[model samples]
Target: MPGQETDRRPLSAAQLGVWYAQRLDPASPVFNQGGHVDLHGPIDVPLFAEALSRLVAEDGTTRLRFTEAGGVPAQFAAAVEPYVPEIADLRDTPDPEAAARELIDADMATVPDLEQGPLFRHLLLRLGEDRLRWYYRAHHLMQDGFSGHLLQRRLGEIYTALAGGTESGPALGPVSALLDQHDVYRDSAARKKDRAFWSRVMEGAECPPARAGRPALRIAREISFISSEQFAALREFGVRAGVSWQQVLIGAGVLHQHRRTGARDVLLSLPVTGRLTPAARRVPGMSANVLPLRVAVDPDATCEALMARVASAVLRVQWHQRYDASELIRDLGWPADGRRQFGPVVNVLAGDAPPRFGGVPGTAHLLSTGGTAEDLGITVTDGPDGGLRVDFTVDAAYADSVPLASHRRSFHRVLDTLTGDADVPVREVDVLDGVEWGLVVEEWNNTAVPIGQETLNTLFEHQARIHPDHTAVIFNDEHTTYRRLNENANRLAHHLTHCAGIRRGDLIGVLHDRSTTFATTLIALTKTGAAYTVLDPDFPDTRLNTTLTRNHITTVITDTNHTHRITAPHLIHTDHDTHHHNHPAT
Candidate 1:
């Protein structure tokens, strides 16, 4: 405690990343992390408060205050008063649970003042005689999801000892211990190696497909749980395939992205607990780093092969997981332009189990995990009933733009596929369920309508009779009335039949520019009961010749400018005067 207030140290790389993010949007509470623990049976509120205070005093991270020292962000342990839980007797209110939830939400929405000392809050609500809810909220710069669980476990240990009239376990190590460990690693040769490994992994990588909306702090969450039977099947499959369930989940995520976006190479942010050293693990501060797992999916390969690939990538990432992702971004020269390097985050929360409270039945419920930089996050954790729970936190700005329910269903279908046949090809895995399939393939594609048997030429003639003086064609600032267009087409048809011996069922080639003459030629050909093949003037001569020969077209109608491009045995120029005399007046 000698340098408690005076000793200022540079933030750890993880904390520094969060510091910059918070500074970018100081007023947004998107960086606030919060959760609540519902205790079914609890009584000693006073003892609980004392235990929390003692825990706060022992953990140096709880007393940390951040400020800019010499124009650089630094953190120091402040000798502040011990943190006390704000007790609320909500038992008398109508719907005490609802009241407590509202309180927690309001506190989580508050933006913490980084320089003003305390960056965390504790609230204890009494719902009934035996029911209680304990809420905790902290800034991301102070703690992460792992640290949150650590603090809860330690607090439970202290509270249990106090209640049992026994000595508590050893206290959490000081924050400086982790800080020193980080400093040593930062300047170590291993750091250089990590940088190189990450550089190689991220080489030739581009940002994931852009999401629907801009980056916003507010989020919409959808929570669902996998059935115990399905989870069991998944675990069994993983075991037989020699991979962990976590890897299977990650592979499923990659497959989902591939199926969703059709991107062969998919990138997902995998959150790694940056507790490489014992000190970093024991201190319980901000020690989480996100690793970009780039999975190259081969659609032709089996799902088992994809899982093996994912497992290998995950193992490699775990080996080099100490490197901070923010540092990697800076080293890679990626600008902070709000474009995400990875798609949805595939987070596997396998370790942070619910903390025990003096043999009391308590359930942990996460309220918020701060604002997500990525548009979507997929969190997989152990469900309450021996199953797996998946929570999707999507950007609120894109909640309407994105299909959350459909995505959930798609991911579930992927999980089902993984749990069933390992030999299924990646491309053959169906993401959509039957209902979604119907929507996409049947309902959405329902475009059929009854149609008369009138041919194109007859329809045009009917329209011309009804609107003779109306403009029927407009090209290059010239307009032709329906009557004149019909007359011209009739004359051309008569000329083709009488002079060129053109008859029904003949395949005629129309080689012309996109002009009124082309329209006239098509109508004339249709009037003669002959099918016309369009030969673009822009096409090469070889292609034109191929089209004519392939269609067995001996006669072709062309304009004066394009007459040389046609290779038909006989050619009739639209501008030629020879055919004009053969046609009768219409």
Candidate 2:
């Protein structure tokens, strides 16, 4: 990869994570951005081409799969060639967008790269004979926010080295070795302890605040932002109350939902940075995972009480992020086949570091909350001034109406308690808006169906009613009917309670895979009025044993064909017909 100069630097690990994330998100503009990348500057075309080739060659851990390893579907260089002007005289147009328009009409955008990836082509606009700003517009498949940063940083360094007559560059270290090393670490004994740590945090988990369906949240064209004075006041209040900015925001987020949907129990899916371990922090990819923090408050719950619960849940989730999102979902027994059950998420990544190169004068003030559920997302970015810029993208159906606006205002007031100090606990702030107070009060008085309760089981039962016969359990050639589902559940219930001494208040733990018995056991446990815990067989034996001991589980009902092999008082294999229904002495 040689032209004449410059060995470029590569993207750091954290930046690369964000880059790959955009690749996976359908809603991301990056999903269709690859076709629009254009490189413009006053440098030798051959030199820049070589620079780009070198940039791709440096081999950031994640990019190699799509770059040089014979792994991706197409050559990135070829897809990019069309975007380069054959021989255009360079000067800045009054608007960079004008150049963008011409390039799109040129049909260079249709070219594909990396198989499924779109072409990453760019038009070189000569800027002052020495510098350039590569006007980039590419589908996310080619690059993400972080990848762009990596490219710019490395390109600048490469150009600088070339100008200085350096024939060699700093060789790339064992970067390619990181992926396999990480995989090995993931399956290691240390990872087992980490998994156990997370399991403890999610022991009695619940889903977060979300609307039932996929109806999109309304996004406003014209948005008036909160003032600096208002944000300051909130910061002061949060400090006095003893919670972080996040707790304060979460409290306010719950209030917004209550005002918008009239639901009270706040189950917000808050995103946490998934990079926790020392090793994880070094390799960057989309490592943000979420946790469902349950905030149970009556319509009359003071800001203080609500904030406290949200804060505690946030702490535990952060401490246990090692178990990634996929692991958390399975442990929670949530469906992953794309029928969305998880609620809307609230993410705050306020650090000011967008993609920038040495030539660019100022930093690119990019504020994005990556990919999120089609629910209400409250993203707080570092504002132009010292204040915070908070963007709330709600599902269009739940637009901020009059009542919702008032709830939004009241939430800001809670932040008012924080203006004096940057830190204040969420619970200390008070929501005293008369209209909002009365609206929530009326809902509470009119019916016991409080707003918070709706955030939980209310919709679940309705889903069951609507889709009862829709393949509740699909075991090998044996589908359990919703009707028969409950009957088999009762049979298991009688067997557990009467024969195995599992009573109304007992906790029965089932080690399982996705099967009819697992579903039936779940139903039976519900019927018997006993709480049951599900541990995937993939979980380490030690971890499962810890849950058993912690929950005081005496009987573990699993099948012999699909088993835990752990000892219990009565190992009742479902394959056996010796199902007894006699009640054991309580």
Candidate 3:
């Protein structure tokens, strides 16, 4: 075993990618993968400990560590002693369950060092004489989602036999065999073909739009959404359409993204089980790869048609999913910039059989790592009674800023649309349900207000009369009271009415920067019963001249600096004597 520990090997493509990511962000726990399972009515501590130790000795990944040798990342089986599972006795605590939860939370908050040996750790919390909680933490470099379930099954099986006073079965094979097979697959022509297929799928593909105002990097927040009744209908529709539940769920996700982004061509990263051969399933290592699943949804296509497209896309990628995503990205020549390759990721995990440890019903809870590599990721797990549980892990930056409620509601709405009718066109389908529609119509769009034929100018005048000393206009450090604004506007109005022979309905061109002068001129124009058009300072001179001439505006009120540009026959520069006109005994 000591000699075997000296053997170093190159990591698989997927593992290499994760290693680079860890190197890039050393503090992130996004790649820390593990879970907690609670087993009630457990009494055989000795047997459980022995079974756990035996399982670890059998799985080489449990003692594996990753590091850089000669500037190249490599993994080796550490010459460490067999893992002795730690036991936390919380039975004497006031609230055993709460204490156990706190212990589990603390364990999940920490991450293991990859450069160090023993990438996995196990703990058994003694909640009470009959209650036990098992916490297993492993890095993604050595384990996948299915590996977690396998760990539970193997632990349960070993415990069952040992507790029953019988000898356990022979130890399972080490993860080295799986790595050997991966090496073989890496050199195979099939792998090359898969890479080609991926290149075609991702050619010229633009990165998905980032959520507005969301930070580029942050810890992940995991939340679970369960759909029992609605999933029943979704399952029924899948059966009727001759598609798998995975396809239906993926179609719904794609539809939700389409409605969320209004992008007909949507791209998502999908995690596919790379356990193509039976040998891959037995080995405990990361044999999964994330591939791009591109769905082209036609607005006129029916729900059935969209599902069919989803099914076809999924089927096409299934065989080629084992292709190394890192290599594929490199071959595609994606920029090395910080932008992500795709948008949200959708992972439909394999349905795990309910684990029972030593005749005690154990429920598995996948703990969050509190970090994510994508903007968002949705992991769909099978729930009880043929329902589906969706665990959404989103980047904290996005979770805090984006309104995912609308997306959640719209996801169910898409499911409803698909299950409610078989032949309904996707374009005609209402992605918003009744409540969401009400939110849009009743809550958001309630813009009705009584209008008693009062114009903005009349309202301003009334406010000026009532709040004469109130602050009316403020620009930078300059402020003007309502009385001052009204008085200045009245002076201008008098000049326009008497000196310029301004008549009602006359169009006046107002050209000024954002200041009190602009405000005063607008009010003055209204007071003189003449219409005013604000001229854009950025507009071309020819365009401004054409607009003034086309509108038949004879009078222009602007600053002295802009007076030279005005083509109107009558010009009243605010900085000139025109504004110094007496109030004329108002």
Candidate 4:
């Protein structure tokens, strides 16, 4: 592909918008695991420098040298010229490890000093002979673990290309157009279709799903495959088994964490890049959104079978991506209240490392960071150098990072065994590490609030003493008196219990409103020890009937106005029947 590589050019507005939004993600650097990288021996200076230059050029955002604009996005460059330390007489430092530690400290400090702009991108530091550290504090935005690793891969490719006597640079396209992409997103088929869907979804609804107002000081972690070779086999195996690489990973996570924690289900706020169009290069805000997948597993389900189920369910949701997620949540009657409504998120980033920049002979390590609510995340990267590195970020309180690190190694073993025995049941794959078991068990055995709490009730009532003799419901030129309404309620309650087979805990479908008949039905149901759930008269009858069936609503109590729409075995109406032996009007 590099043989067809194109030279660097400025990003079009659309590409710029996308990069701007991504790099400027205010909630990035989501992970906090950074350490020194010590080469086994002296580094190749010429090879490294050439690699850096080519990499900076390929990504566009990195090619920039700072100008004194004080901010990155406001202008396009840094506030000052970058300084690369001279490594000629660096003998005073103990060794590469000590030097790397110093480099990290300096990088951390400089990160905060980066004034939300260009200089924060990264500064390449040469420690001494055979040692190098790229130091610069990065907000979780400009790059993520997947992208970082990709960038490194690209860099190595470019470097190797240069080393192997090919310096013209990798092929390219116009700088990706991010802003145009955003504009296109605004007018895209999905956007237009979703707008209509959202309006209808939210029409006349007061209560909506709830969320915590503030972003918590968050920490996350992920355990992914540690062997590129095994991952490759897993890839082939996943295809043959009709599952995605991501589902395989998610299944692995569920198995690893559920078995240890005894959790039968888990909720994950999966993030989607929302890169659904060429215009995806436009609008740079949080194009990334979270989809809460409420996944549950039957205890008796084997890993292979469960994986098949998970894959299908996951694909179904993703395929229906045209719906407004917020609307879907409301329509599905999910909890809007911010009480960990579903569960913590688990993400699978197939990783976006550059696609083999020039095909290099080096390894790239990527550590993903930030997204305030990511409780746990897993990122997979395919380095050109034939290696796989797994990074972990965990809630400090839940488990030890060391254990996760240990499992990363053990997962490699599991991967190998699974791949070696493609037909082997997933559970039979040897799990050498106890920590992996613990995490899985904890995930499978959840402690979230039960179903009853999730779907709750809220009642509102008031007296008209505030407005004496006020008209409540005006129907067919007749006004219903609140006092009179209350009286009818008492009368109906007696009749419903004594004649209409009403009892405690029974759900009475109340198809009414502020209408006089509505008030009466609500009060009547309460007396029978029954709860009345309202169904808006204007809503489709099919929808209303579905609710009735789901809630086991036996009595459909309405006025004569609804006779044509609802005809159940037990339909009770007022005014239509007067003296017919008023034996409870059944």
Candidate 5:
């Protein structure tokens, strides 16, 4: 039998953030966090349902109903029916695993009701005679990554005790205990100190530009793994360097961002488990917060130096991890606009051992961590065979800009360098592997074609002969036909060769008032087989003289407006010349 609903209580800081985000997009499935575990050997269906129901009844966070009181959002613990696993016998399907996956994805896509009760769901699928999969999903307001693990571990304990006829451990602490922990810390002196510390640290920090357009609930993931041998070497190196393995990974991530954006100051949003006290850790609820971790990268320094800095920063942040980020935003008076305060997030999920159910071997697989507001999120977990598994989640809008596969490969290359040698300069670490280098340097740049040895004047003459009546140039709204322009150039060439005695290999200077005559003068100089240099009318007299003297230019052609600036020995004026014949000059 179920009891009456309890009185409404104020939401926690984390729950309040989730509440506003869901209200903004009520139909978004981004708030749903889901995963499944494959159990081998055997599973008792009825017994498993009883275990799950017991787990749900003991965890009050699972029965929370969200609603608005007056104008502020709040939550109340509602007495709801016991949660029984929905059984899907997929053994008759052609591909049981595939069918199960399709059904799970479709169910995850459906939005959960917030105002009513039951913010979580459970499903069980029979894949084979001896294999079964248990799926669980919950709204972010009720559970986080840590809470999800807690629930799974507790469920296994209950099932094992029922089968062995033994006593199980104590159930989870009441949700009110977690609430009391939050209330005690709200007005404590430690919080004021933390607020002051964060205020100083984020004094001049500006929000980074959004990696994708308007933040959507859609996400894209790419998963990769590192060899166990490499991971061992990395751990040994961490021991030698007096830093934890997580710090080394954080350093690698900071170096990666520095290489990509070339920013000396890199800020990453690190998701922290806000369960510092014993009471908070014992309860399964949303006690997670994301804080900014700022690292100043110096390319000239060694990799070990950066790791040392990261270790120190991590120590300081963990001490003050309970401070709510949203309150810090208010303290700093930042705008409510939806801009991210950091770049890519580097989430390191370590120390999660595999769970067993009643002497059956089981493996856990995460499907989604809810929709990420950050463009890039990297999650590093412990692999099954003692290696390292890295999962990259990206916003679909930013996929084209940052290719998931290439980014993963490049990050792996950086990790390899970090694990191999700490003496290497941060700038020397190559993001591209050998194959990517070959593609970029050799294949992509393989653009070459044979060149024809045709001079500019000869090419112009050929075009004029072919398209004689076509307009060749337009200057100041005046169009000149190719034939007419060629005739003008020929007359100027004849005047320059015979009248001024200009010859091949001579350097001629042209000072012009940007008109059609400038083009005619250039073509005429080329017709005489002499090189020409352009002298702008805007140049000073001294610069013009220096250019003419340096180039050994003796002859000068000018329009009337710029003649005053040319002091060369020989002078030819296009506007003053009277040669108008239409014959080519020899």
Candidate 6:
């Protein structure tokens, strides 16, 4: 028999985050996650009900509720009636499979109330004379992915034993004990060390922006699969590189994100099973946590080197996986203005877990886990045919199907590049598919033009004459009118042509800081019909001098008299006043 004493305890750090999120958005179904199991071969309704009741009576979490224990809300044991599974009979309904799907949809639409006891709910639908579908949903505060998997097996055993006129195995302790263990972990020295490790990992790191825009409803999803050959190649490559397949996938994901955002450092949120002890594993509660994986993707690094770094990082993080994600974010001292620390999350599902229910042989299918809580969520699972299925749930407002489609294509291309040639540097990998390459080479860059008598300077002159009073450019508090800019460029053009002997097809070097004078000089180059070369002032003297010399003779134009690095025949310098004063009309 279970203890009669009230098992009360504070919420775990992860649970506290979930509670706060639930309280903030009461209508969101993100925290409500569940799966359904298909039980074939005649489910005895009454006996199944009794088994569900017995299971609830034995497990303390099923009969658990939340209330104010001392000024703060905490979980405690609640005395509630035995859970009776709701039965939806659709055997006689037309299109039984379709009708059964409607019943499942309706049950999933009903959200659970946290304040009420029995956070876990169940629904059994009759598909035909011998087919039954069982759906189970529980608040994330009570269950994780592993717990859901374990529950299906446990229910199978209970129903099987009852059907055989026997009893199931002894029940375990209350989930409240798991919360107690979590509290103990919070106060341990190991937790302090984990905290320090995360602090170092996340220091000076900013998560990348969402690849897609946020949709109004934000409920779009896409699933892509990789070939069995590619999946096998990934594993074989991992073995050769001394890394796990998960780390290899993560490394590939980081490289993908880098190619997408052009960022050297990538930060991703990864989910880990927080089953720190064997007792916690059997308790069937919310023992999963999300942690940040920060990696620096050096473009010059080889694929093996990058995978090795990711593997080492994964191992170190798993050692300190007990650190509370919510608390770690708090300790990072980031602003609390409703922005999440990470934009994308990657999860690997337990697809290999066998469906062990009773003595009957049937299949278990999970209808839905909660939709993504982040802008983009990628879930990987092993397919029934031994391949890998990757589902991407994205916020539509941030990204469209077009880009994500290409993203999926590029992801495969990247994997091929990595496994095809391990010696190539990451920067050398080309993610574009063959079609994209053909388009770029044959269509996009096919820039053929008709010869025209008109020049760029003539076009600008026409626009200035038509809209002379229009604002041409604004830099800081200064504005240049079209007429004024045209006259200024004409003045510089005359100086270049008459004074500096600049003519058509002459190559001139123009070096200046970002200002109105630089714009004027570029326009003047068009008027003189001379090809102009631009250089950043910040480039090293050796590179600048070498580039100037390799390009041959040069006449340099600048806003300042700093031409010591460039060996030029003539140097023309000009400056303009940018002190908020608008240039008067020409």
Who is ahead in lDDT, 1 or 4? 1
Which of the predicted structures, 2 or 5, would earn the higher TM-score when compared with the native? 5
Task: Please report the TM-score between candidate 2 and the true structure.
Answer: 0.50
Model 5: lDDT of residue 410:
86
TM-score of 1: 0.73
Encode model 2's per-residue lDDT on 53-139: one tens digit a residue: 565455342232233233322112222222222334445666545554575445332434433343344444443455443444343
Q: In candidate 6, which residue ranges exceed 4 Å CA deviation?
A: 1-9, 39-49, 67-73, 160-170, 207-218, 227-230, 298-305, 359-362, 396-403, 415-425, 434-586
In model 3, pairs of residues that clash are 220-370, 220-371
Instruction: Please identify which of the two predictions, 3 or 6, would achieve the higher lDDT against the true structure.
Output: 3
TM-score of each: 0.73, 0.50, 0.70, 0.51, 0.72, 0.68
Clashing pairs in 5: none
What RMSD does each model have against the real structure?
13.0, 10.9, 11.7, 13.3, 14.7, 10.3
Better candidate by TM-score, 5 or 6: 5
lDDT of 3 by residue, 147-204 (tens): 8877888887788887787766656566877788788887899887887788788765
- How do the residues 1-586 of candidate 1 rate in per-residue lDDT, one tens digit apiece? 2247678888887787778767766788888887888888754888888887888888777678899988899988777574677899999999998898788878888997787757888888999998888888888887888887788888889999999999888889887787787888989999999999998998766644455435666777888999889888988878866788888898889999899889898888888887776656668678788889998989999888889899999999988999988677666555444435456788887535677778885577776666575456888866766777798887676787566787888999898898887589999999978898898899999967554787788899999999999998887567888887888889889889989889999988887767776787788889999888887664446667887888789988887777777768888887623223333221
How accurate locally is residue 359 in candidate 5, as Cα lDDT from 0 to 100? 92
* lDDT per residue (tens digit) for residues 412-448 in model 4: 5655654675556544655655664566577556657
- Tell me the number of clashing residue pairs for each predicted model: 1, 67, 2, 66, 0, 8
Q: Please report, in order, the local distance difference test score of every candidate based on alpha carbons.
A: 0.80, 0.50, 0.74, 0.49, 0.80, 0.71
Q: What is the lDDT of residue 65 in candidate 2?
A: 22
Q: Over 4 Å off in model 1, which ranges?
A: 1-3, 209-214, 351-353, 400-402, 438-586
